[model samples]
Target chain A: MTRTRKPGISRRSTLALMGAGAVTFAAPWVARAQVKTIKIGMPTILSGRVAQLGTSSRNAVMLEVEKVNAAGGLAGRQIEMVIRDSKGQPQEAARIARELVNTDGCEMLLDGEASSGSFAVHEVARDLGVLCIHTCSEASSLTADPKQHIPNAFRCVRQGIHDSIVGASYAAGIAKTKGLKKWATCSPDYAYGRDTTGEFVLYLKKFAPDVEIISESWPKLFQPDYTEVVTKILQAKPQALYSCLWGGDLTSYIDQANIYAMFTQMEVFAVNMADYTALTVVKNLPKGIHSGDRYIKTFPPTPENAAWGDAYKAKYNEYPTNWSWQNATAVMFLNEAVKKANSTDGKKVAEALTGLTIKCPFGADGTVTMRADDHTLVGYAIGWGTTIPQEPYVPDVKAGDWKTIFELEAEWKKSKGYT
Target chain B: MDLDALASCLASPACLVTQTTSGLIIGMLLFLVAVGLTLIFGVLKVVNFSHGAFYMFGAYFAMTAYQLTGSFALAILAGAAGTAILGLIFERVFMSRVYGRDVLMQLLVCYAFVLIFDDVVRMIWGPEFKSMGMPAAFQVPPLFIAGGVVPPYYLLLIGVALAAAVVLGLGLARSRIGKVIRAAAQNPGMVSALGINTGLIYGGVFALGGMLAGLAGALAAPVRSLTPGMGFSVLIESFIVTVIGGMGSILGALIGALLIGLIRSFGSLGFPLFTEGLMYLFMVIVLVSRPTGLFGKEVA
Candidate 1:
């Protein structure tokens, strides 16, 4: 066997060289770290139909950053946000996160805009050992999947599991009141969609044993065509559709489904149905459509929400979605963590973020507290409402049980083997 | 698996009826898009990768035209004209330079347009989906066709596709210009020797192809929501159509598109999971069984 001293340099020699290089590289970052401004990096989708998701998140982060900086920044240090467009792609997100951490020296990361992108960034965070917060991703696996779990990574948004718990519990009531038992699923064919759909269906059937899921349709996210899906649903004659489709895809589905009289045949219970951006594009949003929103001013119907909405509208010329609240909360959580730990050190802030509570401005019940076990945020303003033609597009906000959400989320986490 | 889908289809008569009509309407639109792709390849021998972009431009142009004029017909014509001009520019500026180049160079040139057109559309329309309100004339009550009710707009779409076929397909097969085109495609050097500018022929073919795509997009705008990447969704199915129907064969495009359109319509009803897969399956089988495609000639 040829002793392959084959490489340009031996592994041990390379390590020695790298060790020296690391020390040299570490000095500048160390010097920069002493600076008062804490740099935060966000990789988000900024183009395509789903651009609103990222744009909303970026605006939200900026809004919070503005407030924090105005009050003399987080822990009396000004926070700077360096944003990059992920294009809703996983690899791009991961690559951008690494560059932000390694190159731009982003001390903290907000890895999200999409669940898939969030997961990719989570792995990057784990490898880089950064105090990272998942801003808008809702996949339960971000915190629950044991293999992917890391101490430094935490999600600041409401998980899909939380949404489903509230959604299913609310759906059971709809099934009973309207006698709409025959169910069908029309979710985007991805983790967030599949997870939310499965959980909602599994729990709905659990809630109402007699409820039957007659059919299902999994169109790819950002799917342009929903004709076949609509026709299939029409053919199935299901009394209702539980959809996880959102943004551009959701708007397209509603418009096309309307053409096929899908709304007439069955009630559409869409989890992400109430974004003002998409609602305005849709020609005819049917009245009395059962739906839920991520974040809207009318949901909490409080003065705080009103002021925030007006301020957000004044800034962006558009109403904020759940992303606005989710992202704002993440940055606010960062502020709380840094203040609590009294340092921006990744490990210390990571430790401090566990069990941290903040006044969630969009919380239906006032505030969300971070769970210590998983470092995942809970008590988001979770709720469902009816879609009506108006400025808010979602009114008559009915709050979901936060205590039930936490309890179910805990039980669900245990089932998934999450600590 | 196909048998399972067939079984599912047989179980629902109304589903079968609605699906068939829906498939044909979709197929007709695919035919419009595919016909242009096939014709361009047939005449110009350039695999125009940005054909879908042309289709997208058509939808946008028609939509804007309709918005400005408040006339559906003018929008349709404007869509056709708008893409034709773009296609002409693509041919004269970029495509003409790459005509004699390697396949890779040609592919790169057209592929560049895909990115360019996408961003351009995004700049103009933003990243949001824009819904085209159904024109009043086509908003008549749905007609009961076979066992299912059909949108009147679908019929109008069929009519537009048929008109395109008559003007394009028949016109290409019958007219003196069509004769020149066919001859030019067969032996461009020979036609050039005979004092005809093959350059004009290539531009015309490219423009016509773009027009057809624009027409399809314009027609589809009412039924389907217009988004920046709407063209990308059409590209895959269009590829499947042109592949099944021999590249550069007009009749081949028509038949292949209908075949795909029907497969999707019925496939979604029968086997929803395999809608896209079925197209790939057919393509693989066609490639293996008949490399020149169903109607294509084996290139020497």
Candidate 2:
């Protein structure tokens, strides 16, 4: 002990060493303070048939993020998005969401998954207790069903029930005018497809009692061959066809249907066909195909909407899809929540997000509200119209009434035992 | 359980005719893909897991060619030639090294190429699905056959598949190159000693297989949506066809493809929910009953 004391530094030297150690320990904290960043994890389907969904969502989110960052970020803390591809798999989506928070140090989650992947990500958000905003999944059960609802999660995209109510109302008018009674459906065999199609049929029947679904074909998601499905639809010889097949599936279905001249035979109403992705790609896109206004530069009928669409197209060399606006709105809502809360804490930000309303280009009246009850978006543009091959594909649009949409949505939730 | 519904669907002549034609269309497409896979296995004794990737590349190449030349015929030629060249290079560089190696080693090598080609396709063509609209020649209203409508493009595919079957079957039976290929497959050492370039035969056979797959892809481009992973489903179906018909047998591939196609079409009508499962069920039954397959020969 005596030898050790002799070898050790004197009081002044010991003090100097202690000071150096303290400086070393405090350096990281000082650096962190100087360069603070709030990371948000985005789990999306970036690699399969729905890759465009993720690409467009990321483009929109980044567009908003760039604007916010340019204006000096939220409370001087820059936002860093850590995006991961789920490969269109549900388990992978859940795993990536967990990894984004637990391992990658993300403070929040921006879930850009489709319905199946979204459900898995929802569970992950609940387990991790992180704030999550669903920007793409439209399946009503995600929010309307209390069993699936979580305190920290919200949806910025349109819901299935809302879409069904609006679509049925629009289609009923056409059905009456055209005297088209018999109908058939060919949707992807999945939750979003089945749920939306069922809701649509249920509401279609309610609105137009004369309409009957004579045949239904549920093709596996990303099914390569539509020959059999097209054949079946042709055999049924329905006056009209209603399909919820989306993204590549919808494009493929339309292309294959054209080969058999199926569209010529029936009045096709595809809920997802109006978006530019499908509109621009389908060869000789048959005219007069009725579709929900997924995303169009003109439907919102605002300078802001047009400006945003033009800017996005200019930047990405591709027109934005329904997902792009929803995701951009999600970012806007998140930014507002962060500003209002003035804290990066998940609980505080979440509480601030509850029922938050913000001005957006995609909103029905230049403003959208995050409904307090379901934590889902409302007051956004909703409509159906006929498609043309050229630009301004859907010229005449019929907008959905949010008031009626809400009333019917509540009843739908009640019927599903989700109230 | 719904006997009336089933009966009504089956009872309709138009329905039966349409379904049968649909089956034939699908069967012909499967034959084009399976024939290549079986040929590769027959000569190389390698499963060629990447055959599907070749098919995908064929479609992409054909698409690019069609876009550039606006000639579907030229596109088909470019597709088959491009994929054959790719197959030749792959055979010379990677496949050549694994000749006479362990079965696992061969499979691993082929599987590795599949992954590589998949990524390559995405990098080149991108992940978005694409469509080559049916050529102007086949864009007319569908041809009616026995009260059922058939797309003109599908009829073209059927014609091309039948033509290929006749040419390949006869070529293998009597052509000089075909005799050499068969001889090499039977005894590579003896063929090599007889001054025949067995390596060249192997390369040629592999390229021919790739060409057939490529041709199938080009024909299918109009009807099937083109994606980076589109080949995988067709590959699985082709494998099932080969297994049911007898691996390494062209006749077997044709028969198996038709059976699977008919089963799928009818299965969808009878049991819509289990159409995919029905294919697997048939494959399972075939495997259980005949491990050697309908036309596969004993190795010993």
Candidate 3:
């Protein structure tokens, strides 16, 4: 037999290289001996229509974890992520929350995007007295109501109420700019829609006291045809349109309106979640299609959001939407809480999270803190231009798909504003 | 209610044109998805609960093809072929067995496909939503219409759907194979008695329907994000289109699609909340007033 070993390194040398590789890999694990491994749970929509949001959230959390571990591993302990797919279902969320707390031994938890899921996780966290950091669930009642179940629940993002607060101001401003003070309201027939629209109209009344709601239409979410509603709207012919519709509904609506020149006929259109994903879907929209140039996003603090946004796109191949960014902030805050407490105990972490001040790139003033009461963060609202050309940073074919035309940094001057 | 408010909306040509174009795009997409569903239902008499699954397969297949070849057109073609094959297999192995069964059984099998396909998709594509980068040609400026830019693709989609309708319509009337299939659809027993392989005809119709669905999905891939529930949305929308257009009637499908397209365009601006409700209300009214849709055949 021909000897083939002449071209290769000695077995001893190969063994030495293997030994070195093993040691190199084991070095970090050994160094982590002194540090306690802290496990955190994130129950989120990992599948279905809003799966993208969950995936982005997970990607953002992973990035933050990598950053924390790189920087001494969250106060000398390597942080571990115990991610569970919620599939956008509340029941799945509840089951996952229980598993994370009981089976996975997670010390803290991050909330999912959907309100139902968050509420499910919130219920479990309350029962177990575990720290729950909520990012996406915007149902204000979750945080506002004290009598509700979640004792350990804390929201790290702006409530859906901010939709109304910001939407009212934004729409009023648009109306004033275009001299279109009269408006009609159309919204998905749901609590989130109703509340947001009601609040928006109420706030708009403050600015345009004489503004009239010419026509009101409430369509069921996911219903396919909009002919009757369109007929009604055309008959009324309001100068501007206000809608709290988001997700697939908004996307479908935009597609429909563009065909009928509704965008052109409506001077200004206000969608609470318009600029984030809806605008993204209709990227190659007709040049003349303009919804609202300015928006009030519940997440993202500044234009310098490039770092976090870049990190997300690098990993997920998509920009972090408002929910993704918010979730990222919430996860970082959870890690910070563990660091501040110096332990992974949920109660200790919760105590540390309460009124704990931290620098957040996702928030205005480069800083945000968990409120002792209600737990909602005084986060920023990014105003985006749905009609402007897309930016290079965003995933658009060309640079002019969308423009961040305006942003409202939700910050108070320390004592005067949100801390 | 207020003249000033309405006046502002009327004054802005940009908003109006954009909304109209948007509606047309939506309507065109609806037509694409609906026409396929209508065709399958017309010939197979199987309601096709899993029509959305075919759509999903198309999107995922297109995503894969795009990833492998980096060609949008090739990806679309691959997607359509893949879906057609899957549809043929489904017809032969599963759907064909239940051809003479109740419509409920057909729905049940398709529903099972929905679950099975969802998991299969997860295994193949993973749970993350993927985007197929738009072709370079589509990235350019759209046709200028009344000083506003209209997306070239929206016009392309409309053109494609119209061309497809015309071709399919002509083929159904003129082609020998199409004539045979139409004969079978009109009278399956008679076609069988005439020594025609009705089973083959059924499979062929199903495959064609699947291909159409795939084409719709492939076209939508660049325009819409690919997610698990994408097919469900399309399925519902297609059902609405079919019903509105008088179920199983190609002309009815086209008319219904255009009507929906126009409605969505105007309603999103004028009545956002009631957009969906209005659609269903119309369906209800149509069912109540005219059991046979505006273009549907009257029930015996």
Interface-residue RMSD per candidate? 2.0, 1.4, 6.3
On a 0 to 100 scale, what is the lDDT of residue B21 in model 2? Answer: 78
lDDT of 3 by residue, A235-302 (tens): 46688787766655665555445444566677545454344455555544444332322222322435
**Proportion of native contacts found in each model?**
0.49, 0.53, 0.12
lDDT of 2 by residue, A238-344 (tens): 99999999767788788778878998899999999899988887776889999999999989878998999999999999999999999999999988988899877
Model 2: which residue pairs collide? none
User: How would the candidate models be sorted by lDDT, starting from the highest?
Assistant: 2, 1, 3
Give Cα distance to truth, residue B227, candidate 3, Å: 4.5
By DockQ thresholds, what CAPRI class is model 1? acceptable
What tier of docking accuracy does candidate 3 attain? incorrect
Q: RMSD in Å for candidate 1, one decimal?
A: 10.0
Model 1 TM-score (2 dp): 0.91
Cα error, residue A362 of model 3, in Å, equals 2.4
TM-score of each predicted structure versus truth? 0.91, 0.92, 0.73
Higher-TM-score candidate among 1 and 3?
1
Q: Give the Cα-based TM-score of candidate 3 against the true structure.
A: 0.73
- How close to the true structure is residue A18 of candidate 1, measured as C-alpha lDDT? 96
Worst 10 residues of 3 chain B by lDDT: B1-10
Q: Which one wins by lDDT: 2 or 3?
A: 2
Residues B146-166 of candidate 3 have per-residue lDDT tens digits of 754466776877687788889
* Strongest candidate by lDDT: 2
lDDT of 1 by residue, A1-419 (tens): 87756858888999999997887687976545545588889999998667877898899889989999998787767889999998888999999999999999899898866877888898898898988899888778877777877889888887788788888988898899889889889999877788789999988987788899888788887667677788777777888889988776787787667666667677889888777766777767777777777777776787888888889989999888777888888888888888889887889998988888888677767777888877788777778888886666876867899888878877887887775
